[model samples]
Target: MWLSPALLLLCLSGSLSLTGPSSVTGTLGGSLSVQCQYEEEYQSYKKYWCRGQNEGTCDNIVETQGEAKEKNGRVSIRDHADRLTFIVTMENLTADDAGSYWCRVRKTWYLGFWSSGTSVQVKVSVSPEKAMMFLSSSSSVHLLLLVFLKLPLFLTLVGAVLWVNRPLKGPGGSQPDKEKPSRSAPSPGKPCPGIQPFRPDRRDLQTLDSRAGGQQSLDSGGT
Candidate 1:
């Protein structure tokens, strides 16, 4: 059985234990650094940072040629042979910088060349101001929704209070008015009616009794 170069690289990568974060989060306009540690056997190999694409392939971004430190534009790499580790730094991050990357070691045997190591997914988040604005807008929307949800209940409670305090009505379906005492006319130059109001009549008593009986009979008939 013979193994192809790509398959051999995959098998080697699975066997090698590289230490680093599986995913990294960064903020826009900020910078981030990651450390990848390899085995002692790969200390003499060239260390590389690459942007991973489909099918286990990557585009090389930067490499350290056994140098202590190297930089390219916004990317910097530091090789530490004593520690068996390499540090990669990316500055002035943006949304477009978010993607999958690999910290790899290049190895060339007698017949083929390949890279093997671990990968990290980098995610660049939105700016702080934009995040805060989104949160503020969401809070305002929730507040308005709460007010709208409670408005009908508030109106119903007010209506119930008004209904409870409404004025009492008479049998004719109209609010009754306070009654004023009646006054009689004065005799010609004799005395005011307020002073000569003591008069008892049998006919008036009879008329009241007849009106009371008539009211009772009408009420019973209606019931």
Candidate 2:
């Protein structure tokens, strides 16, 4: 892969350690403020804040020059020396307020382009009553699925395991009779229906040798 000179400079600049609040907790229908600070030494730069409204919608809250016009002093941007930080406070936050936010350096660069910032996710939650109710509803759904969905799969696996290990047995729900020989019922020179035919014994090896004039000896009473 080939990278342009600008992207190469971006990589050399290292991971953008976005200066922002380490963490934030807020309640719904309330006010919340998110702050970001930059650490690079850039002569002339500006701050911009945009909220991820949806898939492609970015609500611009502040731009360096026109920052005051968009937001009623609820937002402030500062870019001096090596720091570019801003604070955006939103009053009467709603459920739709939860989203990602970004701060970027808006100025001409050697690569002749503006670099947009990395994001911080803004989260909103309600107090005990609503939070508890939401958690309880989630747990109930999980429990219902456990009782109805996973149980069937577990039972099927257990049943399959039990069925495969059983021993094979004789026909007619009975064992083959051990008291009487089964092959005796088959006609001579015909293979037995229920048993495998036996192979010749190794004692026949002597008979094969005797046909070539091998002598048989009788034991003497006195030697």
Candidate 3:
């Protein structure tokens, strides 16, 4: 099919679309991996990982020539010709690492500069780890506050129980001595100081008379 130059470029650009996620997240002091897929025809082309807001002016961090794997400092790029995909990895992520990034294919040269080519924008943010740390610190502070608030009440209850169970004291603050019972009977051969001689009452004399009468009656009946 015959086509104008502008139409031809548009067709070429449309056929070189790159597919990947619009955004990615990584934790501080951690690592992250991104996969960018391209067409099979461009599998042998160079693939690069860059960082900047503008895809046309972004600085390349790591790139793989042909089908080789390349590593530069904390960044690495590996291209898989069989899968028509390139993988970019960043290690030891930090707050400074959170920004706009791009995975691009170097397809052709246009007007003294390499064309922006097919790429996907990836936005990275590092807030999840910070939020987790904040929640943990706040939880610890709350636990400490609860302990501090209840400590005085616990001590007060313990002191009251001890006081209620304490032993009674005497006039001099010493424990009181137990009381002893007095002896009802006097010692052997020792008379009681305030005792008088025993005397028989009317009821005792009546009991003696009744016993003598019963004995006399028994003797008469026997004779």
Candidate 4:
């Protein structure tokens, strides 16, 4: 009798609830291992590691009976009856090897008929060379962004410094020349050619006379 997909899943979930990591990740050409545990009653069953396919079928990789260790090309399986657990190890992993895997058990029951025991899903992830390339590209982009962010501030500071130390202008908005003073200019004792000396007006004379009269009265009072 062939078991339906739903029936198989129900039997697997009800008979044995396998416990292990949901996913495993590894680098290119690296190795990884996973462990699955079952109840003590299923200790005598054959434990197997299989890769999942899209057509609802599992491709068998390695299997063991009772308590034994078996190794294939790059896959290995170990069944421990004493601890009621099985371990699957894969080495020299590549990107193509990344996919869904299953930890399955098989047993004989009901007079020479084989029964599917239980299975648990395990997802494997492998990082190829492209992942490293992506990281390198991301770092370069971040560096460019950092420079772009700081460039304006740097330019602004440079402009401010240049402006602060810029050459000063004279009163007519032009830079003053650095020529020496001309010898033909008049000295302090001689007057400028276009200027004239001052002469007192009538109001200045009247103020001077009043100040002299006050001095004379003070002198008389002292005498």
Best model per TM-score: 3
| Model 3 bad stretches (over 4 Å) | 1-16, 109-116, 128-131, 134-223
How many residue pairs clash (N, CA or C atoms closer than 3 angstroms) in each of the candidate models, in the order given?
0, 0, 0, 0
TM-score to native of every candidate shown: 0.48, 0.39, 0.60, 0.51
Identify the candidate with maximal lDDT.
3
lDDT of each structure?
A: 0.76, 0.59, 0.84, 0.83
Question: lDDT of model 4 at residue 88?
Answer: 92
**Tens-digit lDDT track for model 3 on 117-202?**
67778997765586688899999998887788777788889999999998999898988778867668887877796987578999
lDDT of 2: 0.59
Runs in model 4 lying further than 4 Å from the true structure: 1-16, 54-56, 110-114, 129-223
**Candidate 1: how many backbone clashes?**
0
74-117 in candidate 1: lDDT tens per residue? 88899999999999999888778888887777667656665344
Please tell me which model should have the higher TM-score, number 2 or number 4. 4
For model 1, the local distance difference test gives 0.76
Candidate scoring better on lDDT of 3 and 4: 3
